[model samples]
Target chain A: MTTQAEHRMPTAALPADASGLLPAAEPIRFLDDDGGPAPGDAHGRYQRPATELLRQAYRAMVVGRRFDSQATALTKQGRLAVYPSSRGQEAGEIGAVLALRDTDWLFPTYRDTMALVSRGIDPVEALTLLRGSWHCGYDPTTTRTAPQCTPLATHAPHAVGLAYAARRRGEDTVALALVGDGGTSEGDFHEALNFAAVFHVPVVFLVQNNGYAISVPLSRQTAAPSLAHKGVGYGVRGERVDGNDPVAVLAVLGDAVESARAGGGPVLVEAHTYRVEPHTNADDDTRYRDHDEVEMWKRRDPIARLEAHLRTAGELTDDDVSAAREAAEAFADDVRTRLGEEATGDPADLFAHVYAEPTAQLREQARWLAEELAHEHGAGEAR
Target chain B: MTLTMGKALNAALRDALREDDSVVVFGEDVGPLGGVFRVTDGLTAEFGEERCFDTPLAESGIVGLALGMAMNGFRPVVEMQFDAFAYPAFEQLASHVAKMRNRTRGAVGLPMVIRVPYAGGIGGVEHHSDSSEAYYAHTPGLKVVTPATVADAYSLLREAIADPDPVVFMEAKKLYWSKDETGLPVRTAPFGTAEVRRAGSDATLLAYGPTLPVALQAAEAAAGDGRQLEVIDLRTLVPFDDETVAASVRRTGRCVVVAEASGFASVSAEIAARVQERCFHSLWAPVLRVTGWDIPYPPPVLEKYHLPGVDRVLDTVDRLQWDDAPDSRFLSGAAT
Candidate 1:
């Protein structure tokens, strides 16, 4: 009963942005890779991020990289089960967090420890899932952040639902979901976009196009013009930015988040970046990638680019850089000392928290486990 | 007031939505159309769009939306529309909804319900009929409940929505039109307890959801043969009522599990094993099972042969050891 034209009819109005469906001709850049100011005409699509925010982002990137390395070392020491380092992509990671207010919600992926750290969450709690102590360490409601989701793109719809609920409650809350390039290929990604667009909820889908999903290249992920272009079909405004450029990432993401907050509907921003490290500690970069490719991305490091620009503009002094590095080393040292100690958890905790009120079966099983532990240790105590 | 099980379920949802401002219902065709089965009929008219609405026909998105809304302080009751169609949302249900509370160390509890119209016997074609309760029951951290009677349908649904955990509430499609004289807001025994629909002394007939009616009918037919069959309706599949079922099986010394699903590694199979394990010395014979054949759901014309009927249940009940067994049966290892 439906015709092709009727099926093709646009579901909602075009996004309120002037650029409409297509993104900027080039990835929006406010700073060149060498840390010099980009050509003014090249970044006319968005304004440069503020100096204060840029300085903050730069220091956070420094601390974030140190945290990343510390967690990687903990993995080798068996303190953590595994760690996914966001080393080269710190700009997009920190920029996404810096763009949002504490009242807003953030949905992070397993590779987004830097974003959580930038959100002011304790570094220890942020690494809990990777530490193997619990599935999620921090309370999501208290932190206004969801657990770091491991399944790719599955949290996209959750962001949409939460954002929609906030709107229905008459609150000006926006949800920003951090996703990888490979996540764009998932069905949840498209479904979440469509739902957000249809409801016109406040949400920002930030896709950090970090070149690869594990060893699979982006070429195999999609053949579209760009990950951002895929948003056009869902009537969401699409924007692309140089993820390595801190100024561009913050500027574009800030615009997208604020625009969604003002009810301009959801916006999908694609950050063109690269992952310098392997997927995780267990993965071998040499198997599917070249050392030369890793070396090339290392040259375009996000931290070095932003630090150079800030120093030239006199926004960061020599003393400020030293203070930043010193703070980072102290933070890493604290983390190392704390991680060296073994984690202690009660065995009974396994039966706890499965339900709000434990079922009879759970109670019986818990009792059985308690008795087993008692007999095994010859202790008279029963939990 | 006389009520059909379907209408009772509708009344329960209406009452729950009225009592809780945080409660919202949404799914494909749930709004405006009032659901294809009409169980959700007239909800949108009473609650307005924010409370009851339609969604894109993606099952995963529907359930995923419930997870998010629940996280943000909303009790979302989502409909899977059918039994087999819910497979698309299994990842969301199993990975997030079922595990969110435990995953967060009890920081998050999803007070949501996934309504699935399940089981065979209305002569419906494939995909429309499936007994998928075992999948949810096997997954930890989810409460799986199904209602057979009109009163139980209203009571259990209200309980499921109020519980601070995710529940997979399966509605037996075949029993939807069956009627009783129960009024709105009727209360029944809470979940995790089985109800004895018929009490007897010879053997126990254990069933749930769609198979409860078949078991009761078989009991009535067995009465004509001087067999007193005790029928137990296991309303809640998970957190199963081990005490009630074991007590009845111990008294009767025999149990036959009746279900519309295939018997292999199923909810019925689980009940049979548990009853035997708990009451091994008291059991007069090995537990028997009457269930659908192990195959994909068949066309409407062939479903009658594949589904368990009263005759099949009675035949399985006949296999239970009795004092009247022939002498030759002892030589065949068929006697206790």
Candidate 2:
């Protein structure tokens, strides 16, 4: 019998059906605009989850979008240093993150706050990094999520090593590291892929194809037809999914995660999507990207498509949709309040964690700071 | 009594593996062929493949996997085949191995050792002959150590394996076969201490790695005359043996720092600053440095001019003498 891994690999390239014309095919969508399954659904490996899980996924996507928008506003208002908005790609993050078991580890890049939130990270904690309160907002061991590595694709090898460790320890947990298309060009990405393939480690490299690395477009990044196909050279399974369709992403990722947990080695999942906003608050995409292309992707907004599908399916009423929006707004407000109320970190915290037991030199430095602070306080009291 | 640096390292690895079951040796070509330098010769045969095994060609993978093993309570000794090859693994070194203990708030400890054979003496091309100690020294959590003698070769390797933090043990590639006729030490040496090779009154010569021999040769040349020169070998760079360095410079009143790395912002530069700060009252002259030029290591034919040598060391000493300043003609000639 053919296994799930066999079914996941792309069977055929894009086809031309008509004799007279090659129509601009609607980019692959698992759920149509009317909340019905799309035509020629080929992923036979995964079964749809219960209706509750689907609703939860929808809620998560909404919350992720709300958090992304709030974070962008904070950056614009000068409260946050910078923010990488996940406004257009929430379905891709929510779908894949919701599919994984809590025991599995996540290695996310700077653009993966949506995935972190879907995996139960507090939105305030996630924004703490953007607010510049701490380099890493939360303890990774406590969250089972590594700090968002900003250096393009450097975290891939780290995730592969973690997966290798889990397999060695006989743990069923797998590791999923998320990176952008531009990261695929880095040597660490190739090293990670080669290592995962050679060792048969349970890792799923989730590449969010956002089309540009700052000003450099995907065309300049590689000649490969798609990032997913690059995995073929390493003897691992690769697939492209409708990143805007939560159901499709969930189905593909669920199968991949289960296959990995069962010792089926690694899979490379390329989420074909577009970055609706600039790379970050610091970037201005209007300079590089044609306005027409951005308008074209706006029609494929993940939130709009998913909301339309849910309303048509009678699974979510108009009132229910409005309630979801209101709940997300409230949650974002709560995050804003918490961010303002939390105590600022001490400057001495910089020297606190350089070593397990601070060395003599570090100790001396810490003492000097303490004395400096004490003298300042004394002067203030005397005045 | 005669032992090459490679043989000393081999003996040290064998002894560590025999003494502790926690010790495991790994790297590319380290198992069947006993490593590219043969520093791991006879290890696979003696300790079995499980304890001494070959890994894939990926250096980052080697270090990351060793880190995982270290987290699981294994004392892994990983070797990078060459100095340039270690860059691919620097992320793992700088990110996880060095910072994991602090990142986890002391819940985790990485007792791993990364052995890199570094520096140019033999005719190694550009990538093969870099002095990357400064890179490791710049990283906060990792300890950096280099050995220049057979005793240090035998003792420091064992000590690095036993240290609580990750240690970058840089072995000079050129000295792998340099033989020491003197006997090896009977006991293992402690980490974070400097070894004083000679006692002198005028000046101290501080060096490590392959340059330690150069400093000793310079000391011997100076001693041939009435001038006495002290020679110090800093076995460890981080948690640097500042006490020994300070005491030596205080007694000698002058110092000439030396290393194979380029002069600008080198470990030698740091040593000079620290010595000046701690021993300022006793110092008669500013600490001078006889170091590699601030350029990429030159081609083999021009390497003698790039690397600090006996002549350069003597020239620096001649500049430091207070009495020699009166002879304007001789001083001017030397200066020109």
Candidate 3:
């Protein structure tokens, strides 16, 4: 997926300042397109995770795929208001999120349900925002996770701010911020990167180059050599990785997270992935992209490739595959039952969180609304 | 101690940094150049580069960093080089910073201050002067305040920085060097509390920030015409001190809101609407407003005519009719 037509890796000119990120000549790769080990010596720097961890990672990836498909089906059945499927980019989602320590924070965007789920958030609660209900559906402080922001690149700066603040207050916590290709063009992205670079804040930024921001292609996003190289301008080091290869993504993100945790400053890792499905269930991707082009990417599916690797290694039995499938089915069944229940959106909840102390105006407005709602019901109830 | 508004602000920042370890001061050239208006002058020399420093010329970046730092427990006091330059960071301010605490259900509150030098009259170029309090006052999570006195600049800024929520402090560029030599009065009220700069009984004139001086001047001019005008300096716009304003209007039975922001759908409009609702019985005339025309800040030569001057305030009050003509909406049986 990190091909020439889309990402033309350009040479960055620089004076090598005290803290500029050194660009990797090529995106770090650990696996071939067919799931076989690729030629690279970079992985030799650190010990690979235990075999059991790899198995768990594989299961998590499978679960991520199941969630994506189930959520898409829910959207079709009107169970979910909308869903932005991380269908083809599950590797980038699972790999980056799993690398973070429990104490660290995860800043996800609207399309990052997989990342949130991997953090132990309940599936139904995770979809509350996507389901178009109340504000972000979970307690961020308890989970150390920020609400999935819809505005592009807006949360990136928050990640940098929190990280910088943590460092100043003598806390040891890193922030892992995720954004898409199109989000990289936003001014907030530039600012966050620049701030992270200058302040040496502990943050790991992963830009999932998913080929399109809605209908606009990557070429129209920027004329840079690659999205990773954009970090060089902010004095941040850049690492490009094959986003379709979960193994490669895990290794690269793991290294970056550790580097940040050890106070090596922030790192920008650009994962070359694809959005196999449309931007959202409401979008008609066929209007902009061709089926033939999408077919070429199907060969690089993160889930199928990893499953093929486990089979090739003789680590997978027929029973193991059947057990994973059954688990996914049971999870989906539970989701369907939960969503089948009625949703009671209380009107008073709107005034609950507007301020730490609701202002006089908001209080008055709330009182008026209560009176109006009461009056509408035949004025039978006393105020 | 006697000081200019600029000097008072500088002293306030110095005291804030010294008092709080988490308090940080930064902006473009704010460290080395002391800011264009010298508002943040000499902060770095006393606090060092770690606590006070400069950032890249990206408005969005400056604000984004402050937002994050504030979330993580730093009291970031950021500076926008000019009023118009703040447009780029509007998204960050309106989006994430303003909504984070509310979204988190108050698990965390942002104790940050974004200092903006705003309004026109100093013959500065375009974008150098603008009235942005309305934009921020319109946002829910932010606390918007502006100080019209040298003493208020010192006290209000200290209070804004010390507050637990994000504060948008709009410092008037034109009022920075005014020769008002006075310290905070002993009985001075808190930051959001309104100050009755001058008391009268004919009509109430409400103003804030740079326009407070004009409102007071309009009051003096009205007295020459044998009219007693009460002028209240609305120290803060968001927490809008309605008790003070309503009481004055009830006594005078008239009101005229003054601001440098455009007339249509502005803070002035909000004040006008609220005054009518609260003082409907006491009012003998409809609430009036004297503000900048619905247009952009023109060239330096044309700014005088654009900003709300004393003449405009007096003229608006002069035309306020008190013929005891019942409001059209309350005419006879129409109000039944």
Candidate 4:
């Protein structure tokens, strides 16, 4: 555990060329392909997460995958405007959420609806942004989760500020900001890391390097040795984990979150994962990537691998697997029923909440809209 | 009992920090440097590093940090140092800071103020002088306010920090040292109301921030010629006080907008359109605008020709046709 004194000292005051701050050369892994344990001491640095946590992550991933696919179907049925499937990257998605406490804040991106689902947010509230109902359906203050941010890397500094403020208020709250491989190229990401390091704030940046940001591949995103290695220059400890392995991802991310909570400065964890589906329902993956690469990643599916691991260890039974699938189907069916109806919102809602006290300008506009609506209704009655 | 605009603003920030432990002041050079213009002078000494501190020289990071801090229950007052330097933070202000409350359906509100020392006059070099208020005023969910008097600087900033929404507080750089004989803790008209600084009936000279003083000087100059030009200071641009302005314009029968920003889709243009729409029958002539030409800010040496001053304000007032006679010099012979 990092001492309190160590956490208070800025990185500039620390010794130069500290090896403890560097990332591992290879991505840390415990479970290998085909769900077999990896040979040798590949995961010796960090202890494996509790078995109960792994089981929970597995069940949540199953449900999360169902929710993601259902969301995609909803987009096709015109219930949602768009849905980004977190299909093959379930390990990273579930592990990151499972690593933190409910009090800890999660700053997810637009593509991180699966993480929101794992956080126990109502699935319908999670899909509101894509359904064109509201910008954010859930109250961030109550859920301790920011709106699924759309802009890349903009929320990174927000996490730093919240974590820093919590520290000042003597709260043990940590903030986890999730970013994609492409988001790391943004200037806000650099500033966030640097500010967190300088202030020694309790924040964690999880970069799910899913190989593609829209159509651009990881190779085009950065020339750095690894996205995690980009943290050393900012005085942040960096770690890389096999994102397909739930065991490794949970352990690494859990360790990072705890270290930060214990007052160790912010750490960046890059999970090597793949976007098994197109970037979103609106994207065409065939225009950029090849089919062979997709097939290779499909063999290493996070859900299938975790299920195999659990069964091999006698932790999960056929009955448990079937029960989980049944629950997921029920959840999906409820979502379909709720989203089937057309959303009916008051037109006056457009003028509400622009400010604590609605401005006179907005009041005038609202009056104009009211008149126009009344005219339309009256004309319809005459017709 | 006298104070400069810079000192008044500093007092406002200091008072805010003392009043609420949740208020924090931060930005590049805001710590020991006390800001380049010294508007944040002595704040760090009074409040300590936790309340007022220096940040990395990244504008976007500064604003983004303020947003997060505001979300965590701290009222952050950040400085952009200059007008043009704030461009880097435009995305954060537009995408997140400005839309946080509305996007969350009022679940979250950022009670913060972004203090920018704006506009030209001191002969600074490149990237120093710019009138970027129109960009912020055009954005919804943000209150764009600029104070022309020392007393307003103190009261408006204090009110802005206490407001339950994000505010872009533009501080006129040239007016920092402009002294007022009034004391601190003075109260002006509430926000969203325009003050007729110099009331008259001949014509109305609408201005805000850096151009208010210029408009007042033009009013004084027109008074010397036996014409009474009403000078109106539009303190807040977003929640614009159209009632106050329309009333004054209806009585005056003519209006001329003066601003340092380039003319061509600007706040000045918006005011002209609104005045015509509200007081169309009251107006005796078309609303005129005296603003910087539609070009990038010129070099410091050449800025005198670009910024609207007393002479320029009067020049536009001439087009009002006081005697109901068209000036042939401004008319095209082909039309005649």
Candidate 5:
């Protein structure tokens, strides 16, 4: 429960280079790339939670990376129809999701399986969607996490709507909606931002500026210098953070979440990161981006950076690191086994949850399908 | 009652607002000005600005906010101003408002009604005069209702407001000023029931919204020609009044469905399918649909050619007439 006064600054007095984007050689860093503390850096702003909290964030990211990698492999193996890997943008997902309370809602795009993991959604459930067996993997109300939306930026308005609802109900909940840099090109993004700002809705627009939108560079996405600056036009407070630094992301997101929960309205956070992997299983990034550029982003690996910081801080050891990796592998294996072993969903399941009270037409269709399936597979085969 | 369909709707909304403090009406220009159509005239004065309010110009925001209010335990009835204006709110309607209950496993019920003034007859341009009910009916979670008569305009609105799920209440803009005899009790019409405007044995003319009157007129003209056509007005599109439709089609053995929506995948298509499936043996002719052309709704002057009219209905009836061809399957009681 941080007060607005503690976080507020006079609009005119704030430093123009607070974000450390350009003209300033001094980059914003608390823990350097080698994981050692940068003396006199904004360490106060980087408020560390319990050791377990940091460990949980690291563990989630590791597992998310594994799930992302394996799912891509599955797609290549034809077990999955498609997979959108959040390979390079793990910190953006993990940091923001880690800051969210269970009561808060998450509106994620298709590539945000990492955020879904942090929200307590089982990886298998997300895989079920990529496998094309289910439309939505989990009920949103039960988990406070909406199903991944494929239509770019459409879910933005929904998140705003939900946050408006929460605000009206006087709930201390916030909605964090994840979108790619490319989604900023959509009118829905602007509409959602404008609506959220005007309504004073408690929503966080987390834009993972991964530099490319399915091969389209960020330069082509918008004419604006930075996505965060777009928020100023809508009268929302905006911040840009290094997406590779999980600590900085966590700090900035925690501040945004607190501000939103305290009735300060919505904020736009642009996590400047790069996508290390191709857009999806179907894409080949070699055509659009050079190997040198990929290598440069790879050096700023969110996981490697965070691991280095933790090791230098004496919060993690080699055995602990080995155990975390082992655990992530085990989790991925478990998910793979569950997905591979699980039976294909019954077609009747489609009609089952359409409505709590099934319509007469739906019932008829379900019955017809059941009878048809039974006929095809012999008696009593359809459920 | 000498009231326009719009007046009836406003009266119905006013009554609902008077009856419950939880009932709130919101849309663009719904307050102060009482809407562009003046359907909601004098409501702001009657209920005050809090209960009857104007929302921002954003259609999706209006619907989305109404959904939030509904989830927060308020009954919100939103107006789309016109049929075409609802497209901006389609995502909210399709993704959230309609599916909220099912998505949340019934933990929440979106008790909101979106009033869309649809259909053609008025000299509205293309976007304003579109019949978009088929789009809504195609969506699974929404209950779509279109009122043809003034009494229906009053009663069906009350029913839509009280329904647990989100309901799309489409009013034929052309019928907004059209009045009907009043004195019917304002009660909840069951969701899946069709009202028989006129019952006959020769052929069943199925219609709804503005086309209902055309069907009734067509039935009357056919009656003079020795063909007693049954006229059935389908009130609800989703959870369709299959019983009423099937009963009429079973007796008449011939059916012609009319709607202002495009001919392809119109509500008439659904009626045609139900009739073919349920009364397959009773059918003597293929269920013909008299609907708007597949092209975009024509300009007002050319709308007569696009929209189904009494002449079109009569032409369809003549095409199916047994007297025109004594060996016609329509009279021979043979399935085509």
Candidate 6:
């Protein structure tokens, strides 16, 4: 994007670069059609993530794909409420998440199962939210990962506040908030960007511009040159990276996270990517998108790009690919076993977490529920 | 020290900051200007800028940042500046702060206090005076409270800050200047408890926040006319002290609730419903509510007419029949 647009700054200049907000022209990319290194200063500075990181990214993408398929199959099997698969955009999710330290937080949207899986959350636990179960599948405090936020961009400010509060306590915890392009239109997104910049909070925002938010496409989402450009108005450093290129996403996100940890202001990175599947099982892509467009994006698939690069470099053999597939299948089988059990929901689950200290009214309500459940079960113990 | 509501609130905030380093206080002009009403006056001077400070004029950002801070272990006490000015942050309050802990299933709790200066009769402009306790009370995960006494103001606010859940603490704007002797007794009722401010034999008056003093005055006027009226201060609105109000109603057999929020779907309505449910047999008269008219808060000059005053409370009490129980449906607005 060109150096354009005026800031809505009302106070002292925010924590931003002093110069004008001129973001890079195209998404910063490092890999080509044949997986050769591209040319650019950012590209030259080793946008090539370490070989180990790439290998892990490859594994994560494969497992993420398998997990996505399993979730979709479970929904078909009458298991989950819904599943927003991160199919074509696995690299964007995994690349940025792997850059975060264990102490750091990864705030995921409903569509970001890949982030949770890559962050070491159990495959079964990761799908629990989709399974219509209680709680956010995993312990957020233990894993430093927030629950799946269904509301668009709401978690952005939370991530900023967490990082800001962490710094106040003399902790060096970075927060990476992930969102879709459509989420950037939300008021919470604007507030989060402004507050994060104003407070110099240690947070990195990653907008996986997955081409469409359900049926709403990117063009209808914003009038700005690009989603990343919207960040500069809040006085945050805005950059665009190739979502399909795992190396570039890792390099850019890694740099942003490191810079934030060292007290650099919060940054916004938009990864240009696509959601190859329907928004969920509930949406129809054919209504708004052309088949040719889907075909076009298939050629640019993140996993295929990475796998080709790995194979061409002789870093990944055919047997290794087969082994990766076998591991992914094993994970899917484990998730299937966990989800196959009959749901024996507890009657008290509704009132359990409403407060750390349940009020008199809530306690009374819980009592009523217990008694009613007991009566229904012929005076059996309240489940 | 004889403390007004504002000074009592200041003392509470001061005590909280002194007690916990994790507690932070911030809002517009809270740092140097001591807040628009001086509730946070000198707090920044006593505590450093880190513990107490100012923020931008954006209310949404203020509350959002505070929620974020709370999620990360900081007990943030944010001022809404004015009652209606807090509307901008309603989305954040309802969607995030109020539901974070429950939605996260006990993994994260929003232990913060959102202080709003609410109520009419303060002769302030449009958005300056509003009674929004009902909105917070309606939200599931929040504890809505308003203290009508100086002791409760000091003690309730300190407890709210220390509570392990979010509390929407409404500071009655009109009561900010109402004073009481502070050194007599520092003891105050804990949150979710109701104390009978006055005692009598005929009827019970249920009121909270800005309407408590009005109910007290109405009780005094009723006494001159040989009609005994007891006053109950419902300091907490959410986990409402139903037992106190219900028991009083059972004994007196008559009731009238007063408030500055509109007559429709209000916190007053909530208390009235609960009292009706718990004391249906003992009730001699259907509960009556004396509240602001079902209209947007009018201009400052006409606020007196809109707010329930002593006369309105008395008029509602007079409408309560000692002979027969009236239809409960008509109890919400018959007197007005």
Q: Which numbered prediction scores highest in TM-score against the true structure?
A: 4
Docking quality class, candidate 5? acceptable
Q: Ten-residue segment with the worst summed lDDT in candidate 4 chain A?
A: A1-10
Q: Is candidate 1 or candidate 2 better by lDDT?
A: 1
Better structure of 1 and 4 per DockQ: 4
For each candidate, give the TM-score of chain B: 0.96, 0.94, 0.94, 0.97, 0.94, 0.95
- Interface RMSD, all models, one decimal each? 4.9, 5.8, 6.3, 3.3, 5.1, 5.3
The sequence of per-residue lDDT tens digits that candidate 6 reaches over residues B1-336 is 877888889988998888788899988889878998999999988886778888767788888889888888789999999989999888889988888788777888989999999987878887788888888889999998899999999889988998999999999988999999886335588888999999998999998998898999999999999999999999998768888988899999999988889989988788789889899998877888998988989998887789888888888888788646565547688768
Regions of model 3 farther than 4 Å from truth: A1-26, A39-49, A314-319, A379-383, B179-187, B322-336
Model 4 residue A52 distance off true place after TM-score fit, in angstroms: 0.7
Tens-place lDDT digits, model 2, residues B178-245: 88865654454577788898888889999999899899899999988778999999988976888899
Question: What DockQ would candidate 6 receive versus the native complex?
Answer: 0.52
lDDT of 5 by residue, A1-383 (tens): 11222222112232244343221123235555555565685444446556676777788788888878888877766778788889988888898888899998888888988778767788777666788777666767778887687778777877776776555545677989898899988877888887777667789989999999998998898887678878877777777777887877787788888889888878888888988899888999999999999998888888888888887778888998888789889977886777665437767776765655678888989999988877988755554
- Using TM-score as the measure, name the better of candidate 4 and candidate 5: 4
Scoring only the A-chain of each prediction against the true A-chain gives TM-scores of 0.94, 0.88, 0.91, 0.96, 0.87, 0.92
Per-residue lDDT of model 4, residues A1-383, tens digit only: 11133335232485387678888988998889778898788786988778799889888999889988999999999999899888988998898899899899999999899999889888889889999888898999999999998889999999998888787777899999999999999999998998888888899999999999899998998999999999898889999999999999999999999999997879999999999999999999999999999999999888888899999999989998998899889888988899998965677878898888889999999999999999999999999
Cα lDDT for residue B214, candidate 3 = 96
Worst 10 residues of 4 chain B by lDDT: B327-336
- Candidate 4 vs candidate 6: the TM-score winner is 4
Q: Give the Å error, residue B117, model 3.
A: 0.7
Write the number of the candidate with greater lDDT, choosing between 3 and 6: 6
| Clash-forming residue pairs, model 4 | none
Clash tally, candidates in order:
0, 0, 4, 0, 0, 0
DockQ of each: 0.55, 0.31, 0.47, 0.61, 0.29, 0.52
